[model samples]
Target: MTLLDFVFRLSNRVFRPYPFCHSRPDRSLCYHRRYFGLCARCTGMYLAGCLMILSFPFRGELLSPTLNIILGTVLLLPGGIDGTTQMFGSRESNNFLRVVTGLFLGVGVVLFAEGVLFILIG
Candidate 1:
């Protein structure tokens, strides 16, 4: 098979892949959700963000405006800074930090996408 098929098979143990079911890319194929086609880290980030949102529901709103900003920065800044700095050759990236930041970025991506879909369709 392919990388996508390999990952889907591996991640099937944790949770069912989204609805990316199809024999090939065509009019019937979906992209937004990856239809369960994304790899492990992507799925973990999304699942973790969803769990955090559900668990911390009201707490997310209780923070002051500045704290909210800080929280947002904490969740997103590292990924952007690390990726950008590396691109500009300002500093070499640490592997651990890169992975951590990537996870945060992934989480942010899923949360943002889900929020948009919920607002528009739900």
Candidate 2:
């Protein structure tokens, strides 16, 4: 198969609901008249997650392991609260909030993971 075909198949498989994203058009980001495969929150998560992973090498120099863990945990609270409240039918969330919270959640997860790794390894 051609590269474009392969990429299309891969993206289709990856973006399916229940695992990666809901892929609901209403909750998704639109560009050029096309909805993104993932919802806004997931899109934010993936974007920030990728960025965090890319910057992992520099994290050690900037923050201590304990600090990383603490900061990560703090960052995670907003997303956690937002998701939990929404899940329990407390209230609906907006796409802007979803994206913002998702970004924090992404970085928080990475920082938390890195902190744990540092503790385990060092």
Candidate 3:
């Protein structure tokens, strides 16, 4: 097949494992139909994660492990609370809220991971 076709097939396979989107494609919230193949929150989270890493060099030094842990926990709480409440059916979540929560979750995860890495490797 053509290169475009091959890439399309590859991406389909790569995103197939997303149970939330793949299993119930109709339930997914996407800005465009083309992005319907993936969960919007996951997309936001990963995109923000990429941005966070990219900005690391220019931003400045990494935070200390203690600070990282505290900051990470603070950042993660909102997402956790929102997600859990939605999962339990207390309320429904919209794409905007999901994206915002996912952004915080992504950065928090990175901070926690970096703190662990520092403790382990340095």
Candidate 4:
């Protein structure tokens, strides 16, 4: 009926299938769901990927094989560490840390992929 109500329903419908989504009743954790109500880390990773692709023209020339490997590894390291530690229950990951790490991982993946493509093509 109302715009706010429409958005709420839409989010619920979109996120309903996700295992991690808490549902309408638990909005605090639901960040917003055109993104499947994904966790902050997941959200950031995806968003970052989109940003990377959109900005590829501006950054593409920077990707050489060696730099790609190093950059990718550096970018992914923090997220990997955080995620692994969380998975092992060694520590809990907060949303802020998750987003930051996820952004790095996402950007790294894009750069790594582009570099690999260059290598293969050449």
lDDT agreement with native, every candidate: 0.52, 0.83, 0.70, 0.71
Candidate 3 per-residue lDDT over residues 3-114, each given as its tens digit: 6555445555777665634424443453334334455566567767788878888866568977877888888998899879988999988777877887998898877777
The sequence of per-residue lDDT tens digits that candidate 2 reaches over residues 62-100 is: 788899899999999999999899989999999999999
Estimate the lDDT of model 3.
0.70
TM-score computed on alpha carbons, candidate 2:
0.81
TM-score of each: 0.42, 0.81, 0.74, 0.74
Over the stretch 16-74, how does candidate 1's per-residue lDDT look in tens digits?
A: 43552222222111334344433333444555566656755554435444444455556
Q: What overall lDDT, based on C-alpha atoms, would model 4 receive against the true structure?
A: 0.71
Which structure among the candidates has the greatest TM-score? Answer: 2
Candidate scoring better on TM-score of 2 and 3: 2
Candidate RMSDs in order: 10.3, 4.0, 4.1, 4.3
- Candidate 1's TM-score: 0.42
Q: For model 2, what is the error of residue 28's alpha carbon versus the real structure, in angstroms, after optimal superposition?
A: 1.2
Q: Worst 10-residue stretch by lDDT in candidate 3?
A: 23-32
Q: What residue pairs clash in candidate 1, if any at all? A: 18-36, 20-35
Clashes of each: 2, 0, 0, 0
Candidate 4 Cα deviation (angstroms), residue 1: 11
Worst 10 residues of 1 by lDDT: 20-29
| Model number with the top lDDT | 2
Candidate 4 residue spans exceeding 4 A from truth: 1-12, 15-36
